[model samples]
Target: MASSQEFVQYAADQSSGAGRITYRKMFGEYGMYCDGKIFALVCDDQFFIKITNAGKRLAPGLTETPPYEGAKPYFLIEDLDDRDFLTEFITATCSELPMPKPRNKRKSNDTVPKRRHQNDF
Candidate 1:
């Protein structure tokens, strides 16, 4: 398994041209989040972009493996040296995703009205 620091470095290097990519340590692996949304993950020193129908078609040879046991499948980016292909894949994935909705800033308690107990029937 790749160390979190190493994975972060790898993600940073791979996403040099991409704007403001951030790496967060998650479940012993590293999740690469672009603009506050997850776009990729790093495991065993390999970068895997989130799989989509277009990405699957573009890189049919790439394996769709679960990041962890019993997890959903993600596109395993086998060729780290292929920058052009990686870039295209990233672009395509980003384009296909709908614009992220703004997260509600209100606290859960504040959002939910307080319940009052009434006499039992």
Candidate 2:
């Protein structure tokens, strides 16, 4: 099942204290970002935070699972009500993660060349 919009909003709101939290639709689920760095995912109505040494230190027994099949295992966070804990943990995780690289801008003149088919040739 796909994650509910309410669940993604709650997750983002809970972690807002840590930084500028945002969520984007990805693969029919949601990817949560903190200050431009993706740090978590909301899939199947569950929240899965990216695993980091800092996060492991915070929750020693954190459940780990991939939000999607064949993806890297993430820390499966079940405590969504604990606002303080959620914010702090997110802060720690983001601290350990590198900032996102800036995206390259496409030149206005950039365009894809059409391929000539055998019939057209």
Candidate 3:
């Protein structure tokens, strides 16, 4: 099942204190980004934060679960109401993660040439 928009908004609002929190639709779910770095995912109406060493140190008690099938376990945050904890944990997780690399864009002039059949050649 896909994640609800309400839940995604709630999660984003909860983490607003951390930084510039934003989310984008990805693979039928939501990927939450803080300050341009994706740090969490809202999948199947559940929030899964990226598991990091800093996060472990901050919230060792938090449970871990995979956001989806065949994926690494993330910190399965249950206490969504705790804004302070969310902010702190989100901040720490972002700190441990490397900055996102800039996306490579194709030049305006770049175009794929059409394939020609042997008969045409």
- TM-score top scorer: 3
TM-score (C-alpha) between model 1 and the true structure: 0.73
Q: What is candidate 3's CA lDDT for residue 1?
A: 99
* Residue range 21-58, candidate 3, lDDT tens digits: 99999999999999999999999999999999999999
Question: How far off is model 1, as Cα RMSD?
Answer: 4.6
C-alpha lDDT of residue 65 in model 1: 89
Q: Which stretches of candidate 2 lie over 4 Å from their true place?
A: 110-121
Model 1 CA deviation exceeding 4 Å by range: 106-121
Give the Cα error of residue 94 in candidate 2, in Å. 0.3
Summing lDDT over every window of 10 consecutive residues in candidate 2, give the lowest-scoring window. 106-115
TM-score of each: 0.73, 0.88, 0.89
Clashes of each: 0, 0, 0
Q: Give the TM-score (vs. native) of candidate 3.
A: 0.89
Tens digits of per-residue lDDT, candidate 2, 46-81, equal 999999999999999989999889999999999899
Which scores greater on TM-score, model 1 or model 2? 2
Question: What's model 3's lDDT at 116?
Answer: 94
Model 1 agreement with the true structure over 1-121: per-residue lDDT tens digits = 6556855686667675555678878878887866566788887777778888878778888888887677789887767666677667777776676656888887777778767668632
